[model samples]
Target chain A: MTDDTDDIKGTPALDPVISDSVELRLARQIRELDREMMPERDLWTAIERNIADYPQRKPFNLQGDWMPYGVAASLIIAIAALLVNVVGLEQRNSTLLAADYAIDSIDSGYVNVRNPMVDQFRETNKNLDQATLDDLYRNIEIMAQARKDIEMQVRANPENTKLVEMLMRVHERELELLKQDYSQPGRSL
Target chain B: MNRALKATLSGVLLAFVWAMPCYAAVDSGDLAGKRVDLSEAAKPDGFVKISIVRGDLIVEGWDKDEVSLVGTLDEKTEQFIFDVSGRDTRIIVKIPSNNTSWCCNEGSNLRIMVPKGSQVDVATVSTEVRLTDIRGGLDMSGVSGDVRIQKVSERLRVRNVSGEITVHDVDAYARIKTVSGEIDARSIKGGGAFHTVSGEIVLRDVTDEIDVESVSGDIEVIGRNISLARGHSVSGDIDLEIELIDDALVEFDSVSGSVRLRLDGKLNHKFDLETGSGSIRNRITDDKPKKSKYIRDEQLRFTVGEGDGQVNVSTRSGDISVSK
Candidate 1:
């Protein structure tokens, strides 16, 4: 039954390519290493096998030198790496958060500066002479600005027609004021 | 002998045949240079009936026997025929409508010369009616056409729909009405009632009583010399420039529109103006007390020029401005 279950020959015949790629290269590299600096996996495996031979498991009285050294080294290296990574990650995250806050503030500031009505008012005011024009130009400017602002508000709530009509009246009043101002004396073109 | 020469010959024949009738119509239908003079025609009754459908009617008084109807008709099928009937009392110009669509689609314009003090009744559809220098009463009505009368005597009544009405130099009483159009009449020697719905009414240089009402258009009057004036609007402004004569009662009201009164500062009158939360600007600058109250109190009851005229104004959701 054992012979029938065997799927391979009793001799260990292997491919030279696979042996050189994996087993031979790893074994040769381990042999070249210094004796005091042995690989940790072989030592750990031997200690586990010896401990398991006891009938009832008892705590080992002898100090395992390799175990303590390996544990202490790994613990120290991990703690140091963790501290470094935590500090680096916190710094990067805070910097990103501050940049996002600054960008948001700048975006709001730009919106205030480019308000369409205010810009048109300023352009109209430059050509106005207050003493001669009376409150005509200023009223017109304010009315135009109010209309634009109301239109912008309606973009969000489109059913608000009353506000839109009020703005239209303001625009009409501005035109009336302009026409009345044209008939005044000492008024320039 | 060649194909190109044969094609050129056919093209020449076609051009010559089509151009002959067009050139012949211009010679026969030329009215301006031709001397079709009318002898002195007399209408002793001083009455005329003008029947028009689609043409500009320009009428003036003339001392002649024949009423000259000069027009250039595009279609030979539609005759420019006018049958003048009645003896000396009355004359009627009628053109039969049984023929094809005689509407000179470029449209037609009339320059009729009636006798002095002649009455005119014109009915039109889609053409401008301009009557000037007539010493008679006018009854005009139309659909989709403008009526402009300048320097006319006797009573005037005009009814139009969907067209502008402009009457200048009206020496008698005038009553004009329109729907969805503008009314601008000026320099009236008598009072008139002008009404429009959904249209603006502007009256200037008026010397008579006026009753104007609009649904959604402004009512503006400048230089009015009337004993009583009233204007109403649904959603429009009421502007009045008054130089009131005698004791006048002026009432101006608007539902949701402004009221502006530009009156002569040298007059003496008591005025009452009311508005709902809108501002009141009194440019008259009279020596009157200014009081504040609940929704009302900005009233100026003052006297100017013996305090003969009484002015009242009211509005809702609009301002009242009184300027000198």
Candidate 2:
């Protein structure tokens, strides 16, 4: 695809062309180039044939273009709805009985609310055996079950704010278990 | 060489590696077993950590700046160590982690002595612990054993799975936890938190603010004047007989456990007691409880004799009784 001017690079006489101005080089190159390029064979006939053989796109139809867009929009809405239900409904249904003062004492134990020392504990005990890890997880499950029991009681006795406060305390214990340092030789489940 | 001979040698090596116990010290000095008199020189205000799987552990704080371990190793102990490095000391007994026979004789009964100012941390499994006269902070955990503490003047934290925990003359900030073990503390100063599951919690002569949570276990805090006290439980009765300070704040919440408070002072506190399906008995004053118009609940709110302190108690099915 390159022109014969590609050979000018290694020519000794053209070494000085590198120092020439851009306009001068362009003028000289243009003068030396052919006005038109023609193939030995008639390439226009092949071009025409290829052009006629290539398939043409169909006329624009809203059905094909809008279908994917419509599907994408519906998917976005569905996911949004699912997220709202999962998060928002729980917040709505929750009735926390503990006062902010009471909760502040328990919540201050861990700075992280969602994961709380889970990553740190796992990273610290990367060499822990499977059985030890299983024991840790089993204890966590037991605490979680206790918390779940209180939460269920909260649902049944919504009138009793005491139930709600008790649930909060149980939840705090579960968090403490999650935050326990299993890597420390002084660990106790 | 024959392949069979190599296999036998390799099997022996594997057995050795499998039985190797975990033991390490940052900079241990001297071989610590005066099993023959193993003692190590340690800093007075240093740290000591002890771990065992079973047997009795008696730790005492002494004026002498030394850490010593005196005891016989258990029959199944794969490794026994009393390591001291700089200000840190570790006394550990490791048994085979994969042993089939876990019956008795898995750890050692050892008495460890550290400087009075040295912080102590002990972890055990079914090993009874007796700690005394440690002015430094204490952190202890037990799987199933009785833990007794006396004259601990600094902060203390104890956790046990199933055993009796008794603390006497502890004047530090403390937190004691037991899953299925009874806790009895006397003359505890500087308020603390107590937690238990299906075990009784009894605190006598405890001062300062206290937080208690229990599950299916009774909680009793008797003979004290506390500025603040908070308690919560599920199916466990709570009995508090104490005097409230002028600005005291006491709150008790229970699902099915009854809450009874007896004030041993002049009546000068506001009380808010409520129950879903339980009666509220007020004996400090002659105020009749009001019934909730919306639900079948009872509410009693009264202030007596220039009420300066407040008491809030609520329950789902537990009766509330507060008296002076």
Q: Candidate 1 - CAPRI tier?
A: incorrect
Worst 10 residues of 2 chain A by lDDT: A95-104
The CAPRI-style docking tier of model 2 reads: incorrect
Top-scoring candidate (DockQ): 2
Candidate 2 stretches with Cα past 4 Å from truth are A1-145, A159-162, A175-184, A187-189, B1-36, B293-295
Candidate 2: lDDT over CA atoms?
Answer: 0.75
Residue clash pairs of candidate 2: B34-B37, B34-B38
Candidate 1 Cα misplacement greater than 4 A, ranges: A1-189, B1-40, B73-81, B87-104, B285-306
TM-score of each: 0.51, 0.65
Largest lDDT belongs to which candidate? 2
- Candidate 1 chain B lowest-lDDT run of ten: B90-99
| Per-residue alpha-carbon lDDT of candidate 2 for residues B1-324, written as tens digits (9 for 90 to 100) | 689999999999887764442233221323222242467678999989888766778999999998876776565655666677788888777655543434534346778888999999988766788999888889988656689999888789998766799999887988998766799999888889999866799999999889988877899997566899999988899999987777788999988889999988766788899998999998888999999775679999999767788999998889999887
lDDT of 1 by residue, B1-324 (tens): 698898998889888866553343223334322322222244643556655545466767655544555443333212233333453322122233322343334345556677657777766545577887677687776545678888888888886655689899888888887655589999988888887655689898887688877656789887656788887765778888888766888888765689988876366677777665566677665544354663344555555566678888876557888767
List, residue by residue over A44-160, the lDDT tens digit for candidate 1: 877878778855766775666468878899999998877778876676666556544643454355335435444454454333233223333333444445445444433432333
- Overall local distance difference test of candidate 1: 0.60
Model 2 chain B: ten consecutive residues of lowest lDDT: B25-34
